[model samples]
Target: MSEASKHKAYAQRDGLNHVALVCDDLSSTEDRVPKYFEIYSHADYELGKRFYFHDDDGTEYEMVC
Candidate 1:
């Protein structure tokens, strides 16, 4: 077996589904997001809406409901 495969247990195990963030000023954050990041997609959820974006380095981020 390869060396990298020996430490693959972490990824194979179950963990938290997702992380939730609480923003004090969501509207302000939403307005500023398009100036720096690329807003790629959006969708409506049961609670509210979600905005998906990526920065210059292409790291994915989301504004969740």
Candidate 2:
């Protein structure tokens, strides 16, 4: 990625509340992401875990909550 792309990723992170990523197969993303970054909660919908992943550039985001 270019420097501009890196900057845009950080800028976009600032505007987001939480990334509600839709996954056809959560397993794939889950497997690649770290377990420590996972945020546990029962409020969002059902009683399950959510992954809080940071981009390669260090922008924080949530997955499959």
- Largest lDDT belongs to which candidate? 1
lDDT of 1 by residue, 37-63 (tens): 766666677866766655554345667
> 38 in model 2: Cα distance from truth in Å?
8.7
Backbone clash pairs for candidate 1 read none
TM-scores of the models, in the order given: 0.52, 0.41
Pairs of residues clashing in candidate 2: none
Candidate 2, residues 1-65: lDDT per residue as tens digits? Answer: 76334434345545664455666556676776665453332124474445555555556565663
Minimum summed lDDT over a 10-residue window in model 2 is located at: 36-45
lDDT of 2: 0.52
Q: Residue 55 CA error for candidate 2 (Å)?
A: 1.3
